[model samples]
Target: MNSSYEQELCNKKLETILVIDDSPTNLEILHDVLGSAGYEVLVEMDGASGIEQVEGNPPDLILLDVMMPKIDGFETCRRLQANPSTKHIPIIFITALTEAEEKVKGLALGAVDYITKPFEQEEVLARISLHLKLRKLNLELDKQKQELEIRVAERTSELSQTLNELKQTQLQLVQTEKISSLGQLVAGVAHEVNNPIGFISTNLHYANQYIEDLLILVRLFQKNCSNPGSEVEEQIEAMDLKHIDKDLPKLMSSMKLGTDTIKGIMQSLRNFSRSDGENKKLVDIHEGIEATLMILQHRLKAYPKRPAIQVVKDYSVLPKVQCYPGQLNQVFMNLLANAIDVLEESMIENQYLNRKESTFINPKIRIATTINKYQVIVKIADNGKGMSESVINEIFQPFFTTKPEGKGTGLGLSISYQIITENHGGNLQCISSPGEGTEFLIQIPF
Candidate 1:
């Protein structure tokens, strides 16, 4: 009994061969040979017990007798093969009825092979070993397939997470760029404001002293000699009274002009940087474009290439359009800045090729605004070397640029496109051909 229990436990890890035969001689002979060959063997005298044992604990191989009480080996094989759990276990039929049809019948009932009544111990072991090895290979393949599926799933999930992180990083980078640009704008505004303020401050100081001196002169005339002609007149001439009378109003007027310039700068800044506006408001698109132009004026001056880039504006009387003013300003900034960069690059290329403005074409950026009843169309055209179709097609895709690395972020056109189409429900289209220059048409509903 201890030996039997130990064998059963070993069979859990090793191959356990089940043999069913009604003949004691056949069963004993087969069990002894299989057990000697290092197989864990279980024997049943009848087919019924074999089926019962199969249901309880399936085996690696089944050896059966065709003749039996209650259930024959063929019937037993059929029953085992029909079961979902035991269907794959190899079944071998052993019988004394060696007629061709009887062997064929036994094999037909789901038997993998047939053993004659005087079966060789070697043949049975060889077949059982082959089938068991095949089963082992199949199980290993199943395990590997499952492992591969798990790996693919994990890899897919990781890629998805990585894509999300990259998108978030891109968004943060855009926000940082916007903040940096705004900081630069603020600095420029401060410098522009300080200029007029400085001159106005100095002029106002001199004007204050001049007015005080004039008041003293009036008091003297009232108190002492309101009609003392020659001496008072000589004193007034010595004070240069005629010059003060003429220049004092002019100085005050210049101070007022300085204040007016400061006021215009402030207004432009407010229009360009509508940071608090959330909902759409009626805004003059021309105002936004001009505000952006003022911000980028320093880049417009004459460079080494030729003269200053001439800005030709052909604006029609446009009614205010409802839109997000700040975002619209951003689009204008991007497009105008892009035009400037392209024109600069084209000029440099011409210089490299020893082609001057006389040989090539003069650089110009033309802005034309017109309006239909429902929409305002602003066309910004530049007379520089244009782009090929390939370049123009992908101009609005993020991270697409021909500019040298670090010189351009490549997000300008993409962001501008989004702001126009997605944010404002407007359209932005580009028209270009090689050597023919480029133009951007912007349309927004009024």
Candidate 2:
């Protein structure tokens, strides 16, 4: 009983083969042979019922008889081979026709091999076993191919992501070094100027007070000593005391104003050069922009060849933003300096070409700011020779520049883009066309 149960379990694990033949004798012979070889077997008569059975339950191999009542084995094979679903099933023709033409025809219709009628049982079992083994090997190869393709796709994606991350890291390091060096230099200059300006401002205040007290004493002397000697009157006339009193106050006030302007400029330089490290601070956005503009004041002034580039500021009331003030200032510096550069280039080009009919006659930069529900938007626009579409597309990429050699490092805009987008969680976009001017919009969330 145990032996019989083991045999049954082994038979259940074997491959299934379907036999289609009109003759009961051939069907019985194939069924017994394949069954004895430990292969599960199913029998059907005629080609139509065989196709129906194959569709319902596909077998690993098919044994088809050539001569049948309705459709012949050739037609059945053709139909099976045409279907993608059951096309892979190996079909072997069982026919008595010995004509070489007939055999070739069967093979052409997608038959793998043929068995002559009254065939040896051993030959039938051998062919079925061989085809079943080939089918199993083919299925495994297909599965392995699919698995390999999936792994290759995953690895390629991982490499692409890693490359992008490496580029971002490199960009951050370069920008940090550039900003640090520039900040140190500017901060040093501001520090050196601070003491002298402060001293002058303090002395100006006291000088103004002393001049007022002396003027009052002179007025009292003039009122009380009505009969003064001629010598005193002559000395006052020669010295021009009245003129001194009138002009001295004005001169002192002008000197005080000049010192105050210097102090304000120094303070702006210091603010622009500040480094915020890695922390965010609540700061006035406008103040940072003002500081950047002050630093670039020399570039904005009129030169021998070009007129002063007009900067129109249309500012809106903005709430203090929590941000890296120094980094944000850097972005402003790059954008404003770029605007100035483009305007100067346009002016120089026009002057060189002697083109009085140029559209950029008066180079101007307009800076506007606004706030929305989710973010702050700052727009800087310039009426210079605008960039072409192709140039605009590649402008944000590292080391892309339109300036001549030795004029630009080609990293200003690229670093600014990273600082705004990656560091601040913001966006920087450029809009421009030929002869129209360029505008860059910077948006940062509150």
Candidate 3:
């Protein structure tokens, strides 16, 4: 039986216990009992030294004597309990006092167990073993809690990183979709322009040939008429030389003007269709607005049944801005398109309806660009049905749109905001009131 018990003790895990007492005999006895029970023991002959030892290298449990010199066990326990570092260490009071009041007082002072001096050896072992086991369980619980907290923190960090990545990806997708839509719109416009340009080009060539032939005939007549015979001069006068001179010049001028207009339209289309990825360059802000306007020209110059919106260009002779021209062009397109939509809505709702004459309200879009010391500001304003304060506030928020169903994707302003702020380090703002129209101000640093 003794050998079996010895084997069991050897199998037990090692636990450290501190014994504090003024009497060397009591300290030695406590150390031997705990040590034989498979606990590693430390003995202190003074309460002050014992407190220092426990603080420096905390043990699993402490057996403290109630009466000691300089400092008593009660005082030591109080001090230990007060210190956060050593407070959780299980403490037992070993005193000569067998009174219930003394045990109660020790317990009140944060002692986990109380043992009377002149105690039976069996009772001493039982209490010491129980308290040591409790200390072991507490240490294990604390270790598991610490590990759990670390895991939770790690998971939270990973989740935050994933969320940020997802947001970035969503923003990128939205921008890509916007660009694709713009490309498709450009292609459609190019197709529509081809028919008018083809015919105008053909007509101009024929008209130029006709003018050349007519000029040759006139020169021949002038040369011959300088020294003309009477018969030839009489024939030219009868054929109305004055009428030909007057009518021919007017026809040439009209043809030339028509050709020039077609050429201008084609040039605008080419500028709008130019592929977009280039580094920063000195760009004329007006050119960006013009390109955007060309792309929206079809929309603006629609049937007369639709309101004829007047585009007022208030461009200043500003210095060229150092920026990505294509991105700025996109910003212009979004702003101008929004302005047109607003103006169209206003025309539909004729607020100035009580006039004597049935005069159509001329909606107006105004674009202005200015240069400051270190930044360029582009403002696009529209005299149309404006927005409420609440609507204006959320205009830049992602997926927010004022248009009716199936009319808008709601990513235009939001993506424009991100491109200006995140990519170009610029600012986009709006000023609006209900019937007073709206203005968008975009500022880019040089």
User: Per-residue lDDT for 330-402 in model 3, tens only?
Assistant: 7788899999988877765663563443244677899887888878888999988789999988998767898
| Alpha carbon lDDT at 204, candidate 3 | 75
Ranking by lDDT: 2, 1, 3
Model 1 lDDT on a 0 to 1 scale: 0.83
Q: Write the per-residue lDDT of candidate 2 for residues 1-446, one digit (tens) a residue.
A: 37886678676777889999999888777787777667789999989999999999999999999998879999999999999999999999999999999999999988899999779888988887788888889999999999999999999899988987787788788877877987898777877887888888898899899989999999999999997999999999999999998998999989998988888888887787678887899999999999999888888887765678889999999999989988889899999999898888887777777755544558899999999999999999999889899999999987789999999978889989998998889999999998788999999998
TM-score of each: 0.53, 0.69, 0.55
Residue 35, candidate 2: alpha-carbon lDDT? 73
Q: Write the per-residue lDDT of candidate 1 for residues 85-150, one digit (tens) a residue.
A: 998888888887878998888778778787776877888889888878887887789899999999
lDDT of 2: 0.89
Off by over 4 Å in 2: 1-12, 20-25, 43-56, 64-87, 91-120, 195-263, 297-310, 336-364, 381-418, 425-439
Instruction: Report the error of model 2 at residue 312, Å.
Output: 3.4
What are the lDDT figures for the candidates, one per model?
0.83, 0.89, 0.82
